[model samples]
Target: MQDVKADVYVPGHGPILKGASALDRHIKFYKDLRNIIKDAINDNIEATKISVPDTFGEPDEGRKNMTVETWLKFYG
Candidate 1:
């Protein structure tokens, strides 16, 4: 969406985001997640240990987060 310079985004869930703040937050979430995965991989950590909720020590409040198992399925 950012590549296209979208002015608004309507996600599958929730209301339409009308500005950049929401988009920024969305991007930050993915960036953080990717960093966590990268760091774990670099440290030679096992894929089964990489879990979103476990890494954060709490459940995600609203978003549907992915598991490391899913990441391995795609990027392994």
Candidate 2:
């Protein structure tokens, strides 16, 4: 994404994101999420018990729980 320069990004869901900073924020969000999940796994936290932090910027309760469940299936 950093290699591809664009004025705007059209995601499959959500509103259109504008500017390169949007990409940066997107990348950071994923990185932070990955780190959080990895840390949870290391701490022996149960997937069903894990909670998404507010800093993740994901507001949808269903989506947040689904994301953690999906990642747990893959990385837990």
Candidate 2, residues 1-76, lDDT tens digits: the string is 6787899988777667798988777777778778889989999898767776665364687887898988877877
Q: Which stretches of candidate 1 lie over 4 Å from their true place?
A: 3-7, 11-18, 51-66
User: Candidate 2 — worst ten consecutive residues by lDDT sum?
Assistant: 50-59
Q: Count the clashes in each prediction.
A: 0, 0
The best candidate by TM-score is 2
Full-model lDDT for every candidate: 0.63, 0.78
Q: Per-residue alpha-carbon lDDT of model 1 for 41-67, expressed as tens digits? A: 778788656655333355553332445
Kindly report which residue pairs in candidate 2 clash with one another.
Answer: none
Candidate topping lDDT: 2
